[model samples]
Target: MTVLPEWPAGTVAVLSTGAGAPHAIPVSTAIRRGDTQLAFALALRRESLVRLREDPRCAVVLLAAGLAITVHGRAVVERELERIAVVRVDVESIQDHQSPRFEIDAGVAWHWTSEEAQSGDAETRAAVSQP
Candidate 1:
């Protein structure tokens, strides 16, 4: 079981999948439902939907400033709201990147997993450069 973290504000959320070659889509309306569930709104019948339907496993990356938070999990179609569908993800892993970090320079990025998730490691972070 992966413990999830709260996504910070002013960041971009990206949904990624590994159904075939890696794929990712920018998510705009994602919100955390609880400690274990993450929900995001998207258009119905999108490529992201097809990939997720084929493989529920995915990663949601939140980026803001220069910091990134990645959450790996399994997602399901919760329901539909008009022309959009709501997807709920069960978080399974968490990796937070912070090195000399501050609220102003926090950045998030999303990517499809080329391999299965592993426990969080410290080697993935780089020095946060100020612009």
Candidate 2:
């Protein structure tokens, strides 16, 4: 079982390359009913994809109100574009800064493999669609 962080909806997320620089963007995301999973989409430029191809490790910082969640994981470029690329971030470790006893666990991150994600989504949809 994986333990995930608790973050509210519509939070701003800061994504940092393996380098020192960072980019902040508003997140349109989905979190599992429990703290088990999370998924978000990010658009990037050709340069960004190239950079990620060279360095797959990245960090995501989510902040809402005063609460914050910091996650470290591997990033994958799903689609490349002239002006934009779609990137998926798989959480490796998640931390809640506001919590005194912050939790950091493996559930934060996932294997960013297309097959795994697609199969998981298919199964989830099937289960949900069942009466």
Candidate 3:
């Protein structure tokens, strides 16, 4: 079954088009199908929808706390006239940085942000130091 990272990965970065740069955004929600597939619920007119229509190959990244999960897959945008659809991904690979390892296979790699390596590092860095 598709497993969530140690922390909740609430957003992903996506390319607007096949050859465009990555654009990251917080996803509205994600739904799991069985154990190896996932569908991201999104509005039909979003940038991700436009890009997926032109090219089904894309990477979906999930970030939370300090862990990042990047999945490469062939995406199918099942859109309806109602302007809403699910971006279904036939997961080709999965990756994780921090873990005892994810429950699901068909994974690629794992990565931990610098902040995560040291708890509250990001927050500490963001805070102004009192001289």
Candidate 4:
């Protein structure tokens, strides 16, 4: 099982077939309960959600400082309220791009419970810039 460290706020690159091109959407994410799960907010009209419904396969890349983690997984969308939607991902594998660190192998289920969900949205401007 690949144990991924907490995903800092960043743009999530969601692969979808509906648009005929992969869409990279900037989203805010929070990890609750010791990396047990991740929570993010999204607008109601985003195409990625629909794509996820059609196909669960996706990827998320997070970079902070010089460290980067690229993850490939199957995502299941949970709740939808107004413009906010929560997504749960079953992580299949992750690649650390910074220095060739440990890699998360296959067959790993990334679970997220309601209690561990964070309550707010991620800051867009803060997440998009690299420092």
Candidate 5:
């Protein structure tokens, strides 16, 4: 197995699903498992989750902390909790898209506007972290 580059927790990434048009969404809960696997949780009602259920093929784009790469893989629904679906991606390829012309200084910033949402996010992250 190919070990993937280590990315920090909460590293901003875009999860792309589907085949033709490709539905993409910003995901902040992505976590690296060991070396070759990445995992994230999505709300059960999210259309992206539905699309992923239909097509396991997906890609995660990361452009943060001076790194720019696209991780392509196949996703599998590992489990489902009360309100979120935990998905694990078995990484197949890591394509570097970095250029010397420019450098990335930081990752996408995110803030919660409501305490309820923040609490829920924390719970989701905890669930995703479980074995």
Candidate 6:
């Protein structure tokens, strides 16, 4: 089993799948549930959710300062909320993509433009963090 390392605050995660022509999306609420498990929340209207439902095989690329890790896993919808769905990924393999040539100064930064959206994101993150 692959063990996940501790992710820094503000780390960015991109969830991807090969369901059809390769689909990927940046997920902001991703968090490590355990050494070999990860969880994140996705909006119900997201197309990536549909693809995940069709095919659970997926991967999450986590990027942070001076670190890049790719986690291969199978995803399953764990809970359905009013506006979002909590998905859990059971890790299969972890690959460190960081190199000695260069260093990543920072991870991707994103901000919510609306207060309502920001509040919703906080709620989603809280929900995903629950046991």
- TM-score against truth, every candidate: 0.69, 0.52, 0.56, 0.61, 0.90, 0.91
Ranking by TM-score: 6, 5, 1, 4, 3, 2
RMSD of every candidate to native, in Å, equals 13.4, 10.8, 12.8, 10.7, 1.8, 1.6
Can you list the residue pairs that collide in candidate 2? 91-108, 91-109, 92-109
Worst 10 residues of 5 by lDDT: 1-10
lDDT of each: 0.67, 0.53, 0.53, 0.52, 0.86, 0.87
Give per-residue lDDT, candidate 3, residue 107.
26
Candidate 2 stretches greater than 4 Å from native:
6-9, 19-37, 44-47, 80-83, 99-131
How well does candidate 1 score on lDDT at residue 118? 20
Candidate 1 lowest-lDDT run of ten: 122-131
* Better TM-score candidate (1, 2): 1
1 or 6, greater by TM-score = 6
- Candidate 1, 9-114: lDDT as tens digits: 3246889998899999987556666777777766776889888889999999877665467889999887665556668888888787656745536544444354
- Could you give candidate 3's per-residue lDDT for residues 1-131 as a string of tens digits? 14543333223333223636665555524544534566665566688677677778876665555556776778776544343565677777767654665433322334446756444432322221110
Instruction: Residues 1-131, candidate 4: write the lDDT tens digits.
Output: 26767543433433322335676764444332133334444556878777777877777665554446666777666666655566766667877775556443322224335533422232322221211
- Candidate 6 whole-model C-alpha lDDT, 0 to 1: 0.87
Q: What's model 6's TM-score?
A: 0.91
Query: Which 10-residue span in candidate 3 carries the lowest summed lDDT?
Result: 122-131
lDDT string for model 5 (1-131, tens) is 25677777778899999955879999989988867788999889988898888889999998778788899999999999888899999999888877889888888877889999889888988888885
Q: Candidate 5, overall lDDT? A: 0.86
- Backbone clashes in model 4, listed as residue pairs: none
- Candidate 5 residue-wise lDDT at 20: 56
RMSD of 3: 12.8
